[model samples]
Target: MSHAHPELRTPPALPEGGLRVIPLGGLGEIGRNMTVFEHAGKLLIVDCGVLFPEEHQPGVDVILPDFTSIRDRLDDVVAIVLTHGHEDHIGGVPYLLRERRDIPLVGSRLTLAFIDAKLKEHRIKPVAREVKEGDELSLGPFDCEFLAVNHSIPDALAVAIRTAAGLVLHTGDFKMDQFPLDKRITDLRGFARLGEEGVDLFLTDSTNAEVPGFTTSEGELTPAIDTVFRTAPKRVIVSSFASHVHRIQQVLDAAHLHGRKVAFVGRSMVRNMGIARDLGYLNVPKGLVVDMKVLEKLPADKIAVICTGSQGEPMAALSRMANRDHVIRIEEGDTVLLASSLIPGNENAIYRIINELTRWGANVVHKGNAKVHVSGHASAGELVYCYNIVKPRNVMPVHGEWRHLRSNGDLAVRTGVDPSRVILAEDGVVVDLVGGRAKITGKVPAGNVYVDGQTVGGATEGTLKDRRTLAEEGVITVVAIVDADTGQLAETPDFLARGFVSEEATFDAVVPLIEKALARAAEEGVGSAIQLEQLIARAVGSWANRTYRRSPMIIPVVIDA
Candidate 1:
């Protein structure tokens, strides 16, 4: 079989070995997540996802989990089961499936269709078996069940996998959305059955674990948006994740209530809305919905634009409009309703866009002023509710930061789970199940992989360190030429500085500082290309603080002649 036809060969019977659960990513960090469960030689994966790019990464799509650890075990992966269509849960699928082609994908109709769309974008068809609530499948050695759960999107599942050792409950992104726009609820009976039947481990969503109570439903935001659209004196622009059909539904409904035609901009926003509408995940009265191009042809005040990039991505529809690059720009008197929360790290970006809109005389809507976006993950109270329902022998928190995970672990213990049973797992740490008992088995190298355009590479923590340094100092580039043979200075060093100073008058302060840097490098003389480069780098970087207010990225480019 070609390496491309990645087959997770599942042998029918569970071999006589203990079950092993390992978290590759999404353990200590927020995204680029993967969870692996191996019993004997059979392997099952849950939620292959990616992290959104940070500020430093200009052209990267999403940071993904490093698959090297599981690459060789590709044949052992019986099935890759997804819980929903969130990028943090399914973003890595296309990249993962591109390499391991034979693994049968499993998810609900909506999720599968979304994955299919993404895979199609990559020009790869991942073989997926449609799954739904109460559906069960026996793959190789693992018995898998998908239980419908409510979230920001439809077809979210709280999966229960029964292995030879015991059952592992993997809850993908979820919250107790009793009055969800989708009217979907977690299968309480199924959860109770798992409790009675006995569950060995519970791997739950901790994205909102730190919050106080039950997650707010998407339905709750409809009235707020309705009021915004209904009363707004001008045009309306809304932003959110493209996959949130429930959120999109609210936006559409509000548009109708306001007597405005809704137009969706952004390629992702367009594609996903089309999929959801076609699949019945969303309903739009025939003539009420249209494209941005069509909406542009009408009076701006008569239309409402729903677009992607609520996070303030530079090229996203919102960002493009902010910079006057989008085909349709929000003008004065336009109410830019930021109907989505700025995800933690994305606050600055979101605010940056908000500032742009406000600069252009558009009114911005946010939590500080009004209700827009509600979370989909259960808060503290709902998590406690889940704890009471599952009553697992062991609980391992997934899908949150270190503090949130630790907090959830504490909550689990407070809810009657043993402190010993509430394991704080880091990326790559494995917990072994033996004779129906579980304990930390070992650890592995699990980290994040950042995808820059077509090249996918592991995201180095050094970048974070650099960012921290840049915050305190700034970035400086020193471009210099060096002779390959004598290691002699070929020319005066050229210095480029940014984020460290003010006007042209202030910027020149770095030039002299760089000149002294060259003198130090010239005095040292070159031994090898390596030593020369280091000398110039150290001298220029060392003087950054005394001259400039901040220490900038010192790029000492040593061109060998």
Candidate 2:
């Protein structure tokens, strides 16, 4: 199998009748899924999404797929095709639409509804075209067919794109759940039909490719969740992704069966579940769901709460509850059910919340402890089955980390796919399908565009480095008054430190080093305040590193006396 090379250069012009695939994100990571397809000088985008910030990305809200390569070609974009409504698959829609407000969005009915509601909050009305399974739409030069696929969320789809170059099938996040709560299993029949018709290239979900066997069915979690609601002595708090309609449906059924009222917490959970109910995606037992205020009035044993932050996001509802900062406190004997799989890069944060909730006397139940959650992507066995059914001429693994991608490629090869035809790509790596062959041709500018508060792409690596320094080593400020005639110290340097040294006397040893550096600068006839400040900063930084084995941020102020 061929893998992407880090030394790739800018791709040459697309071959005649060729389809160019450029993945801006979701290649080597778990979220921020997006891909740009160019054929006949028009672009068809698939899955504009966002990546949640990790612990190292301080103060960042979300990360978007860098649109630098396609910024100048927004006019060529025919539509943004979303396969599902999961945040990683659709959260970046509003941001992308902000660039071109008139860009049409095509997806299933529930998927469009979810995105439309989100867009309303951004004050942007979308031009949406809703499609269902067995629906086909002609977008520019690409003829697209949407097929039903079962996932954690309702109305998931896998799209097959037909162009002059060949047919490319993109299986957006999906799993073959034989006993899904909604009875919507992934369409292996459709895959077989496409295989009979000849799939030139297949872009499959690789999120669970590293896992050995088939994923556990969602139905298995019903009994587990019901048990939690039945046995809990107090309020049962179930946390999950806001878009996980099926899981919430099971929660509602369990609550109804156990004679308890359910209340949705978190703005997103309320909005999304409300949409799901109105759209008939989520079955709400009448009188079983109540307002948070109404549920609070009842005895704790009769109430069940559903909220977000299954991943332990610091500002999310569950995290706040764990920190005792939310209205719904984790009291003694309360049962907390984390009803989602742990996302990559979130192990530490999730464990911290689990520990905190346990400390607060809540019995924390998670995937590691019980059959409370399952992945939304197909495992290796299912992937191999699909590979045999589809039997595409070329295979490309999308939406996973490097290990998952490599493992997926290996699975395809083991299923008789040509080793050379398996394309292993990361974000920014360009692949072209020409003459029914897909290969990495070059690279593009696919970097993380961080969203900090109201600003997008404003946070840089340097900013994050400084934030880490401040959080880890702290900052020290040095103020020295210098004479006007000579850049000599007029007063002993005063040191103020934060997150570095607590006591003032702790920095006493560095004062003499600063004085000596100032004297050397004076003898060298350095009269500029900027130069003096630089000298003092360098001297103090060296002393701190040498004496305390700490390299904190140093701010030197030299005042002309």
Candidate 3:
């Protein structure tokens, strides 16, 4: 494939002997983190994931990475390694497993459990292997070690894979939270040990590279959540990401301390919390966790509910509750706490839900108003700290947008890594490691595979364009019944319009113009139904554009009797 940017010189095929590091996704983007590490002829895939669609991708449920590069080489793949259980990190497993189910999956116990549950929904039973921190595994030509890392989710890990080329360290979405709720600080000591062994290339999370200071610890939110529970006048509802076990733990602790019974809302919240409690990741006091059905019997002051939709997803529990369409209505004097960071591009929707909740007589609290949420990714200062500790010969920033990756590259240079040693790569750009040197070799077929409903890659660019057209300009349908021999209209054409104009007034006026076009086509000796339909379409389209200054989708349904 040709280089998208000319400066990124393309090298020859896979260098027969060197290790090739190709990121299929999670470069110049926030989600769908996947990387391919190939040594000799064997491949090791790290973090097959998905990206949530933005507003522009209408009707899309999720965006998966294009795995065309590896689809044909499934036989050489050793295993699929997962850093954590976040949807963006593990959501693509089912898609990949459908191609080849024999490939083994390696991750922490909880991570495997999460992936197993996700796979069960797809009716796939994958080969899963659970590994803990400090456990090492040898697969093909690579030696893998898992190091515990602090992130929003429990059991997150940073991987160190040693190959013939060199040791490649990938820090998967980590923050150096010294006082993490689980007491599993991002293994700075282990990272230092790896640095002593000499890390050839370092791949770090750049999600918060634009932010200057170190991210606040998860422990900081405990006091704030306690305050909310202490002063709440009625039932307290907390919203956060379903994968945020630490945030949910804080909510649970506060509820237990305030003598309130907790109920889990949202499908994901209920399922994930149940998994966490079963796996001993979440601690719930006896009889403190009540079912949602028991909420009505409990007094308002004695109840606490934790739900999903901190990002203001339209169909999520929080949004439905805010819109007064949920089974659990927001009553007067209720407190709704948004205990998750406001992801970029979601401010408008999130604030709208907040406004609705406030209008419904509930007090809303979020990071803007109180310290209820903290980022799970490391900031610039923390990145600098990691660079000084890891001391890699080369650096590649991943898991962020273009600006974030560039900022992270700058941080790496500031840490004394030569500018040339920093690899600022985009998705699909292959970086090869040969003789301890990293360079952009070539590119691959890395793009987005949009998931709309149950269909993957069904919504193409043209489909999205048509959907936008219909949304903006509406559509028109002309149904004409004609005699088989004459190829002429048997009756006046039936006209229908939607989203374009009012059917009663505007459509009635346009019907005559369509009929006239049909008559003109018949007089011109247009004998075929296809020709007549085309004539009607062209005429109606021109008239509608001239009259309304808008061109809607015009459909001509010719029925020949």
Candidate with the greatest TM-score versus the true structure: 2
- Model 2 scores worst on lDDT over the 10 consecutive residues at 501-510
Candidate 1 is scored at a TM of 0.87
Off by over 4 Å in 3: 1-11, 480-492, 503-539, 559-561
- Would you list the clashing residue pairs of candidate 3? 11-441
Put down candidate 2 lDDT per residue, 277-311, tens digits, no spaces. 99899888778888888998999899999999999
Clashing pairs in 1: 6-101, 6-102, 473-550, 473-551, 474-551, 474-552, 475-552, 475-553, 476-552, 476-553
Models 1 onward score TM values of 0.87, 0.98, 0.92
Q: Rank the candidates by TM-score, best first.
A: 2, 3, 1
Cα miss at 92, model 2 (Å)? 0.9
Which of candidates 1 and 2 reaches a greater lDDT? 2
lDDT of 1 by residue, 1-561 (tens): 001011322223333767888787788677767888887688899889888877765456788877876788788888898888888888899888888787899899988898899998889878789989999999888899889888888889989988778888888888877777777887877888898888888888888888897777777777788888887888898888899888888888888876899888888999999999999989998799876677877876688888887888888999999988877767789998877776768889888888988999899888768988888787999889888988989888888888888888888888899887787877777677777766775566666677766777733567556766777566767677766665555765666766666554554454555456556655676356566666666666666656554456776777876
The lDDT for every candidate, in the order shown, is 0.79, 0.93, 0.89
Best by lDDT: 2
Alpha-carbon deviation at 454 in model 2, angstroms: 0.6
Of the two candidates 2 and 3, the one with more favorable lDDT, higher being better, is 2
